[model samples]
Target: MRRALHKWGAAVVVAAGLASGGLVPNAIARTPENPSRVPPVALVTLPPEAQATHKLILAGGPFPYSKDGTVFGNRERLLPLNPRGYYREYTVKTPGLRHRGARRIVCGGTPPTKPDTCYYTSDHYASFQRIAP
Candidate 1:
């Protein structure tokens, strides 16, 4: 039937898109508590500013921005879900920027310094790549 063929064709198009990474953009793939879809970046691969921010976070700061150690609500739900106050955000200084930039490091867990996981987002909170330790 023509209807059956159209349905089959749509499914094939979707399947091809998934296989080629055309349809499912990072935002759509990254779901709450399912960071498996999120990409991973090595610690050394991060920008120098991000690396420094990471260190400050572990050292419990002397953070440059007052909001550095504040809670990250993760309202975007790009990250794995957790209780309130679980995630803390830190700023990665952008070269020549007078104020806090979009680049940031967000880590989740207790004790501030030793987070169970950390993520880097160059485009603010639009997307996150898990930091592989």
Candidate 2:
């Protein structure tokens, strides 16, 4: 059963990767319009809000909130399987919210000045969608 689950998960990631480029468009709302066609939750492509977060992360921001560039312990193991401290998470501002929302940009690499790749998770750490700048 575990092996089966792993394969299923692998399939989902592959689907998301294919959709990462242009399978889903900018205006594609993330509703269950077509479950089969819908990209994996982790790789649902970047939304405008997430895109903004990506920009800020790359800019080395004076982040709106304090806990922006803290080391992200990938306790959930939902990411690309990196070691602790290898990933640092940044808050993605949710408009009209007093506190940090569930959205975040988890980047992996060195120096924090530059990262190899980054992923966005609108639903916190439940899932991650890769983004490229």
Best model number under TM-score: 1
In model 1, where is the ten-residue run with the lowest total lDDT? 1-10
Error of 1 at 8 (Å): 31
- Those runs of model 1 whose alpha carbons end farther than 4 Å from true positions after fitting are 1-36
Quote the positional error of residue 22 for candidate 2 in Å.
33
C-alpha local distance difference test of each model = 0.79, 0.65
Off by over 4 Å in 2: 1-45
Query: What would the TM-score be for candidate 1 when compared with the true structure?
Result: 0.76
Model 2: pairs clashing at backbone N, Cα or C within 3 Å? 42-129
lDDT of 2 by residue, 14-127 (tens): 222233453323432222222122224333356667767677777888677789899998765556555779999988878898889899988889978689877777798766
Evaluate model 1: give its lDDT.
0.79
